[model samples]
Target: MTASTAQQVVYDPYSAAFKDDPWPVYRRLRDEAPVYHSQKWGFWALSRFEDVRAAARDHETYLSFEGIDIDDTAKDMSAPGFLPDIDNPRHDQLRRIVQRTFVPRTIAKLEDDVRRVVTGLVDRFADTGTADIAQDLAWPIPYAVFFDVLGLPTTGSDREDLVRWSHGLKDREDDDPRLTPVAWDALHDTKDYLAHVLTERRAHPREDLLSTLVTAEVDDHDGVPYAPARIDRDSEIVGLAFVLFLAGVESTSALLSTAFRELARHPEQAAGLVADPAGIPAAVEEALRFDAPLQVAGRTTTRDVELHGVTIPAGERVFLVYGSANRDERQFDDPDRFDVTRPPQRHMSFSEGLHGCLGAPLARLEARVALEVALPRLGRFEISGPLTRYRSTPNMRVLDSLPVSFTPSGRTS
Candidate 1:
């Protein structure tokens, strides 16, 4: 349904229908209500590619210090503003400390490890004839890489707990009031785990990112000239770890699942990659654009602002829908169609600003390596059953299960 100024449509983030497929709603918002206001949720949204990108770039106007989610932004979680919740100066300082670690060069070094993880996952179901790629491959690969990258042990139930915490952090359920509390518990547990790990690593430093965080020093910004101070406080370190967990595991996992689902739907696209593995990079970009892993990003307006002839009042929460913006007709030629070989079009999938995804290089690297290894092995997998999407969180687009049937080569098994 095309929206027009004559008819105003309500956008409720809590609704399950909206969670299922937001493309239609996004299109209407872009065409009709460029600056859509949701009376039910009490928030404004910018769905157009240009509007969303502009809001993301102008961080001063669309501040992150107010928290990044409409629901969580209103609550007092009793925690210091983390990466997604903090603004510049502080954000730049904290991000720089970890930025060097996620550069392409650093991520490229993990190619072998990622391949190994992918190989191991595929081997488990290679002879079974059917596999839920989301569970069997996409899900485990990221957590495995995340644990390895942070120099944490890939043993016991710790990794499982991390996954749980990651999910809880993003899950949003308006029906069940307990959902938010449970999510907070998960967040706290993760922070506590990181604090414990920081203590152990600090006493016995190692060649890992966590250890680097333990020993790194930065300006205190206390006073003139600034005194040097360790940045590894339990509070600060947990925030850093939390952000990494979300980016490294949750979003990357979704990207892989979404990419494979698209591949199963479109054999020709997969054929191109199978024919030449070098084209895997382009496929990855297309996947990121087609079905962005991280869908909605939250921000708050610093003051009254006029957009698309509508004036938004001061201090109103806004959602910059990356999922919608990526599909905006103004941006891509055929927005809805998934074309791997589409011409170069910069997408807002990873966002575009100082607060843009820091783990983008690592995400692309992991997805590319996973595709390079799995696509050739699967030969031509077809969707054997219905795809189940996780609906607890409207912010993320992830599959709980994606069952596919493939003639297993049994080569690695």
Candidate 2:
């Protein structure tokens, strides 16, 4: 065994340095302490692919009951945020109610709309040959798609409110009450608005997804017929909506941004993708593997468990470092290298087991469609100015701003 360097290094997820470049720290943790214990945060972290996958699959032992975020006081576990927090059979129940809505076929129906949105977004800034892809294109695709699916009014301040609340929910700072309070407020405000929409849907059910949710029914453990209207009695229904908005918008946006940023830096790779649009799918997959959008997933041990010879006590917090796991040397060959044509392998980016991200299909679709449209329009682009990252949150690899200049292709889809 290698000499322990655990004492010489600290793994602080919130630190600016970690946010900027976490691979080195991740590499050290995987080597020296696969089951890393952070004294400051009072949690155990697993960076290896096998360990994180096992823990994610074994939900009974490593539970998400407390919350999925790193902060102990992060009350996303309460009310509408419970989708990510709750365990089965309740989690299964909630997931089942809305499962059909996000199926591949259902999501497939959005391809035309996705292309329209993507092309329009790209064309909006194509004339100038200069744009922040993150702001202009990446963020709006998922935001518009999700809004349209939910049957929400996707115009003006109402749409802006949805986007604001979606981000506010995730961007909060636990140490600073000022930063976190707005997130709490966004949660409450969005829930209230969703409730209003639910009431309106109840009175006049429509073809929209929210109406389907409001009117959907399922069977309980005892085989009793669960009331469809029971959605009105609790925040669980609203929580489901809240999660769809949060996950759909935030993660996918960050993903598109990161993928494009990488493509811009590696123009040769981007040229290859542009030359053969067929490679865009592989590129998107590589992007997910290369720079995962959401990095860490939280869990709590139900009982004492040993990992890498270290016994973590029952009820202790555990973080499944997906970002680290994706880059683990033992997992992928030349894991750090972003190869578009790497043979497809399962990655922890979308997580694993039953609690995996519900919006994975849609996220993939949004990314592929956006890249297909935008990359061609972008021609050959490069970063025009200093790139900035969103550092308010520790769980995601988000680009705050990515400035770029490109030669307009004058292409129309």
Candidate 3:
């Protein structure tokens, strides 16, 4: 609104040559227009930490309704994971139901299980000398952990299908049509599995995430109890499950990969983290802020509102670029350089408001334990192989192969 602020803003996120690396542009947006509308995509992007934080808190103003992008595919498939893509009353109930399963105590209980899984993956790959961090370590940890949490009966079939579908969705191929009939078939099979699980829950409830959903009581806005809505037989639970697996693998793995990528680039920073193990949290925060896993989240405005002097009209679709905001100069000092000691500025990695990720605490736990286990075992891990980026990805400053060589601390007597 002010001339000084106007001087600090820029509109086009895709305009960055480093659109892949858009922090410099986000720096401008946060300084100038904390809430910026982009004409190119015909949407808005929130850049400032405060605005992003506030936007996250109030679900009423900015709704966490379902996404319609690739509507043909997602429309029939938007299964809310008790994570609430709907408005308050419904989202509130759904969120409450799901929240019950991921509490501190529940997650604390899961710590041993999660650690064992991560350690298992490390054990499998540690002796191999080197492996793709995403595929080998970061990806599978969350993939398996989510299944473990959701209480899915994974037969390895689910994972293979999920990875295939995730690749297809993330522009890994040409939307779903590339393998349309086949994609549909795989989705059908997964749905049948979930349906069987749901039915089993109906017959005999268990203490897992799906079972919770199966029996969750939906509280209407009028405070009346209603049976939880049936998960659509044809919904994107499988597709979204794929999203979660990819997210489990991609995002956390990205953090791990990028953390190593950045640390190896600046051994001094990596060395500092190793020097005092407690510092790994700060280092993780820096990794989150400097290069978050999620690049953007899409929303459709229901009413006309102005943010940072930019008017976002009702019915316009916009992307809240979390990756861009993480590097806002107004919020983070030395916006580009990865500084481990930097005070933890609020970031949009898991997003802020109503739609903020339900898996937040779990993802945080996994990543922390991962780095805790990784950095120590890594004993001066260095990128020692060909580096590549995830193809056709919209977010995540990720690498395909983060090859590293750490002093092998093996066979301790």
Candidate 4:
């Protein structure tokens, strides 16, 4: 843990090699530098479990007005209702507007709908001995379910445009933290579409989340004296829809695909789930900790702080490396191994504290039900084709193509 060793450890969030496998570098950061500063990106990183968790909880010290992504585009252009980019009073106000929708009880009520989506997708390929999990199952289920949750059209050109825009929003280059031209276009189009939806909802409110967003109100704490005000800002509503749609679809898809991919590698674990479908929920937690979808979250230090002999000045960007923290040996036993029966434990996959993922319950339900319905059908499946990682963003660890060869089974209801 000397300066020389620390210097040798290159922690690049935008590197192609790092994206392929970041664990080794993550380990080095935790052990050698603990508080890593990258001159290339002009940001500091916290790789250990305690440090990242602590930072996430200390929202006052680690302000989030700069958005959660380390890229320039997110920090510069973060709009209203981008929950991760807002600080409290306002953050809490906006979050409360939609919090009830994501509560466990509310999300649980959607199990039937979620299952219907999963079953339909599985039916399409369950009888076929070969299939791509990413395209055939992982990608479609979230898109269908989330779009339904928002009362958006789930078919035809509309769905196609949303899918395209989601991909475009994530487009980035290796060693570069700027959004690509495609990403910019995607962002604008997505906002435009959401704005249109909000306008429609204002004119004719429906029994949908978008309608609620357009009509919801909050206490105007930032205004002159406190008063109730309508949450009618077009940008805010659009931003809320944008984050919910993009994160809802992309993160869940990544989680589902990663779970299946890991199971394909460790057939014994897959057999465990096949034997007792009850263990599927635990399997989902393990998948999240084993390989988190979104890796790093950005924070700006509000006051000078010292950690492990490094003094980060106030107003500096800090990255809480959740992907690394989840695997910190200090927190979990045999952190590298994938075990569905690891006795449920807390992890940074969904983040922590005030900004914890609002859609977690829904994501977990979708993953558990998808596995329960699909695993038995995909008995002894093996990864048949070369696995390709998502090129959307360096922070995401998702399979773009996960072709599997399995024993064909008759379609199930």
Q: Which candidate leads in TM-score?
A: 4
Residue-level lDDT of model 2, residues 1-413, one tens digit each, is: 23256655678887766778899999988988888887887888999999999999998998887778776324543564367888888788778877888899999999999999888888799878799988888778887888898788778988878777777766555233234776678767887788778878888989887887777665434553333454442556777776666666778888898899888888999999888989888888889989888799889999999877788999898999999999988989999998887888889888988788888899999999998888877889999988878644577888878899987776442
Superposed Cα deviation of residue 282, candidate 3 (Å): 2.2
Model 3 scores worst on lDDT over the 10 consecutive residues at 170-179
TM-score ranking of the models: 4, 2, 1, 3
Backbone atom clashes (below 3 Å) for every candidate: 0, 1, 5, 1
For candidate 3, write residues 22-127 as lDDT tens digits: 6667766766666665443456677676666666666566665645221233344346542334666656655675676666667877888878888887877675
Residue-by-residue lDDT tens digits, candidate 4, 1-413: 66677788899988888998899999899899899988877899999999999999999999999878777657644887788898998899888878888999999999999989899999898888889999999988898999988878899999889889888888888878888899989888888888787778777989888887777766444333111133333457677777787788888989999899999999999999999998999999999999998899899999999998879999999999999999999999999999999998999999988899999999999999999999988888999999888777666778889999988876432
Ranking of models by lDDT? 4, 2, 1, 3
Which residue pairs show backbone clashes in model 3? 56-352, 56-353, 77-235, 77-236, 139-249
**Cα miss at 99, model 2 (Å)?**
0.7
* Candidate 1 structure, TM-score to reference: 0.91
Candidates' C-alpha lDDT: 0.78, 0.80, 0.63, 0.86
| Ten contiguous residues with the weakest lDDT in model 1 | 222-231
- Answer with 1 or 4, whichever has the higher lDDT: 4
Residue runs of model 4 more than 4 Å from their true location after superposition: 220-234, 410-413
- Best of the two (3, 4) by TM-score: 4
At residue 199, give the lDDT of candidate 1: 73
